[model samples]
Target: MKMFWVLTLAGILVAGMGSRDGAVAQTRVPQKVMKYLESHSFQDLVRRYGNTTIELSVPSREARYLDSLPYRLEAGFRVQVVATTDKQNASNIYRQVKQLQLDSTYLVQEQGLFKVQVGNFTVRDSARKLLDQLYYAGFKDAWIAPATIHIAKKAKVLPTPSDSIYFAIQVMATHSRSKAEETAQTIRKKWNLPVRILAEGNLFKVLAGNFSEESMARQQLQYLREHGWPDAWLTQLLPN
Candidate 1:
């Protein structure tokens, strides 16, 4: 009976392998699978997992870089010059207001209208001052409006020891430092993980987790990929 069972298992394994091989030979690879294969290259895998140096301390150059990024959004105020459904009219007004060069001017489209806003002020009084300036500058309709505004990020203090080797999950990379900082903040708030932004050349990489174990970093990487970051990967940080 034991020999009979062994023969049956061997026959099943052989049949399964033959069927799989036949299917592979007969069918074309699915487009999605092919696209995934094309997008994920061996070079990418090596870049993420290969031995690389990590500066545990923020260098002065990187410190200045981080200081330029938007830190966080806060309840703030802005001077709204106009909100009109006419796109051409809005464009004209935006161009005129932009010529004044009062502050960071933005022509934002929302709720079927283009709204021109200026200056990110944490205090309503500061926004009111801008509004007054706009009125004198021929934008009489400008008024202070409550809004969310970006503040410059302070220099980051890395917690990892300079001599320690650790693993981290790199969630994303972007050329925009502000966008990278925003993504890092969102991941930190959502997952409550220790997030770090690494500026390499022109790209800012957002990485989470300072795990001592590769297994733990892999687990976090899986979680991030399942949640939203499909391209998230585990990276080892070697002491520099």
Candidate 2:
């Protein structure tokens, strides 16, 4: 009777594993096992299994990948359009700045105020030019401010297999490497998706996801725009 019961249980397990819909399979699983599976992701399962059963020969690959990211900082200047304790006012000023179609713009929260700044310039004269433009544009209080900025480096685009293409959502771009990385981390933690920082010209772009379909990227872009990153937009990644 015990052997017969074991054979019947084996058959049930096999049937559950072969089901097309996971609902039927999950129904057959024990409550405890089902709960465990529900709580853990597929990546977690693979990581746990691999750590216990496999030996990684090259753990330094992870360190090398991190080291490949360029991180350089230097003294710079920025045109500060507005510094206000009122969040709504600061946001309104940011939109006004965007309307002027400046190259780079970002909001910095420092010392209990939101500062809307634009143009990452290596020299004060360049920043002063933007400040004058802001003044003429009705931002009379705009001034040049000294800031530490990220020195952008050319990003190496790795060739994709079979010349395949992908898309991503650019949530933010800034002259501060720390700010870009921080934003990337926040997005990753919130959405549980891959985030990358790419240097282009004089800015660090924070991009999220590697979606194969443009529709999927557009969906994610809409979601991000509705969320905290109101300026997020879709970008295509082509094979080199």
Per-model TM values vs. the true structure: 0.37, 0.38
In model 2, the runs with Cα more than 4 Å from the true position are 1-71, 157-240
lDDT string for model 2 (75-116, tens) is 887888888999999998899888987656788898899999
lDDT of residue 221 for candidate 1: 56
**Candidate 1 regions with alpha-carbon error over 4 angstroms:** 1-71, 155-240
What would the TM-score be for candidate 1 when compared with the true structure?
Answer: 0.37
Deviation in angstroms for 151 in model 1?
A: 1.5
The collision pairs in model 2 are: none
Identify the candidate with maximal TM-score: 2
